[model samples]
Each structure stands twice: as C-alpha cells, then as structure tokens.
Target: MALILVVEDDRLVRRLVREVLRAAGHNVRTAVDGRRGLRLLASATFDLLLTDVLMPGCDGLEVIQQAHRLRPGMPIIAMSGGGQWLKPDKCLNLSNRLGADRTLIKPVSPQRLLDEIRDLLGA
Candidate 1:
C-alpha cells in the first residue's frame, strides 16, 4: 500500500476519500486545509497527493507547488467542485498548469479516484 495525503476542506468529502482509500489498502493522512497539508508534506513522506482545489488559508495550487518542491517525483491529483466564480473545468485546467499530474472534478466516483491513484502509482 502507498502513503497518500488527502487535503480537503469539506468534512464529508474528506472523510469519504479517507475511507475509500483505506478500504483500498492505502495508508491515508488528511489535512483540513492546504497550510496543514504543506506542513505534512514537509515533515513526512507521501507517495501521492490528492487535494481539493478550493480551500481557505491556502488553495490546492499552492499546495501542489510546495509539494512538488518538497518531493519532485510525487504524483498529484487535484480535485474541485468549483465555486460561484470559477467553474470546475477551469479549476482543473489551472491545476494541470500548476503541475498537478491529474485533475478530477467533484463529485468524483470512488472507483474513478482509485483508478487514477492506481494508474499513477502503477500498482
């Protein structure tokens, strides 16, 4: 199993992801916001990062940047439900531009999410 950090502000979403990954046999850690996510990235090692794009205190784009800096080879999957101002497609495209290896629009299916992670990890 791989160690994955899941950064999401929405409580339900975060819990859902954590449970899904755990059920799939991945060791999962979570952050409520991007700042904490970055801190975790700095302190520990992660095989993959799965993050939501819109968050308070630091968005997923900045998290992706810092995570890349901390571990250049780590694969990142950016997700977004979109806000009133920005659409999900735009958020995902921006995430891609900022170096996220993959982007997913919410509500992401558990199977699809697992597939993405497996593909990235080649597991």
Candidate 2:
C-alpha cells in the first residue's frame, strides 16, 4: 500500500476519496486546499499526490509545479470535473505539462482510481 495525499477543496469529495483510498488498503492523508497540501508535503513523505484541478487557493497546477520542484519523481494524479468552462481536457493537458504522472476525471470509479494509481506507481 502506498501513502497517498488527497488535495481537494470540496469536503465531500475529499472524504469520498479518503474512503476509497482507505478501502484500497492505501494510507491516506488529506488537505483542503493547495496551500495546506504544500505544507503537508513539506512535513511528510508520500508516495503520490491526488489533487483537484480547480481550488480556492493555490490551484492544483501551481501545486504540481511547486511539488515537482520540492520532490522530483513524486507521482501526481490530477483530477477535475471540468467546472464552469467545461475544460477538463485543457486542465488535464496543463497537468501533463506540469509533470503529473496521470489525470483522472472526477466521479471516477474506485477500481479505476486504484488502477491508475497502481499504473502510475508501477506497483
């Protein structure tokens, strides 16, 4: 099992992801926003970071950029529901440019989430 950091601003989604990761036998930690996520990253070691694309403070793209600087080779899975502008693809492409290992759409199935994580980590 891996140590996964879930960074999402939505409380319900964050809890749901926490539950899913826990059910998959992975250790899970959560941050409500990118700033907090960065703080957590500075203080602890994690196998992966699963973060939402859009957030109230320090968006996921910025988080990815900063995290990459702080921890090169750290795997990141960027998630989005394509809020407002319906630009999921654009967000995903940006994530790719920022060096995320993978991108996942919101409302993803638990199995798919686990599969993507495993694939990215080569587990």
Candidate 3:
C-alpha cells in the first residue's frame, strides 16, 4: 500500500476519493485547499498527490510547482471539473504543462482514478 495526499475543495469529492483509495488499500490524507495540501506535503512523506485544479487559497498549479520543488520525483495527478472561466480540458492541459504527471476530469470513475494512481505509483 502507498501513502496518498488528496487535495480537493469539494467535500463530497474529497471524501469519495479518500474512500476509494482506502478501499484499494492505500493510506489517504486530505486537505481542503492547496495551501494546506502543500503544508502536508512538506511535513510528511507521500507516494502520490491527487489535487483539484481550481481551488481557493492556493490553486493546483501553484501546488504542482511547489510539490515538484519539494519532491521532484513524486507523482502528481491533477483533477478538475472546469470552473466558470476554464474548461476541464484546458485546465487539465495547463496542469500537465505545469508539472502534473497525469490529469483527470472531475466525476472520474473510482476505478479509473485508482488505475491512474496505480500506474503513477507503479502499484
């Protein structure tokens, strides 16, 4: 099992992701925003990061950059449902460009999310 950090603003999505990962035998920690996510990333060790693109406090792009700075080899999976101004594809593309190893659209299937994590972590 691997340790995972989930950074999402939506409560339901965050809980669902945590449950899914735990069901897959992974240890999961969650943060409501990227700011907290970064703090957690700095303070502890994690095998992967699952973050939402658009969030309050700090955005996922910033998180991605800082995460890379903090742990260059750790994998990052960026997820977004699209905000009022940006489409999901655009957000994901930007995330990829910034440093996310993988990008997923919101409402992602539990199986798909798990699969991506597995691929990233080589689990």
Candidate 4:
C-alpha cells in the first residue's frame, strides 16, 4: 500500500520487518545501517521511513533529520532496542523530539507496526 524503507542494523529484525510489510502489500526496501539507509533514501523516494535509533556508522536521528530535510512531509517511525548503556524509551523520546512522526520500542508486534503504518498513511 506504500513504499516503506526499513533501516535497521540487526539482520533478523530488518528481514522480519521487510517480510511483514511486503506480506501486507507494501513495497518494502531495507538497509542494514543508517548510512546505507541514507544512501538509499537519497537515491529514491519512500512514503515512510521505519528506522532503528542506534547504529554504528550513523544513527536514526541523523537519518530522520536528513530525511525530513530531503522530504519534508515524509512520515517517520523510529524504533529502538537500547543496550545496557541506553534505554529504548529514552531513545524513542529523543527521536520524537527530533521529528519522528511515531516511535516504537523493539520487539514491536507485526500487527502493531502495520496499524501504525495504516494510521500514518491515512489508509
């Protein structure tokens, strides 16, 4: 129903998200990290961006800022499964302030993700 870019460092998470969205009829593309995500984003157009907040090279926050600058009205959902040093909720909070249209903690249910996407897409 929409072109979505899923940006996450964890391979399993990225694959799961892509598969779920695809199964639901979305055209889903994915990147392994935020830098790759930005590269893909720069070269193409996406109706929504679903990204993880923590990554090695670049982070979701940077991606969000650049994505917003590149496509001002693009809807963004930032997700995080924070490590020992950080908290998922705190990361999500920061992402919200940085202009994420929505946020989710990791281990998000597929149905919930789809529901949020439907709401964001006004479907």
* Worst lDDT 10-window in candidate 2: 81-90
Off by over 4 Å in 4: none
**lDDT by residue for model 1 (1-123), tens:** 999999999999999999999999999999999999999999999999999999988999999989989999999999999999999999999999999999999999999999999999999
lDDT of model 2 at position 46: 90
Q: What is the TM-score of each candidate against the true structure?
A: 0.99, 0.96, 0.98, 0.98
Q: State which candidate has the highest TM-score.
A: 1
lDDT of each: 0.96, 0.92, 0.95, 0.94
2 against 3, candidate with superior lDDT: 3
Alpha carbon lDDT at 78, candidate 1: 100
Q: Which model, 2 or 4, shows the larger lDDT?
A: 4
Spell out the clash pairs found in candidate 3: none
- lDDT tens digits by residue: candidate 4, 3-113: 999999999999999999999999998999888999999989899999999998899999999999888899999999987899999999999999999999999999999
Please identify model 2 stretches exceeding 4 Å from their true place.
Answer: none
Per-residue CA lDDT of model 2 for 2-78, tens digit only, reads 99999999999999999999988999999999999999998898999999989986999999998988878889999
Best by lDDT: 1
Candidate 2, overall lDDT? 0.92
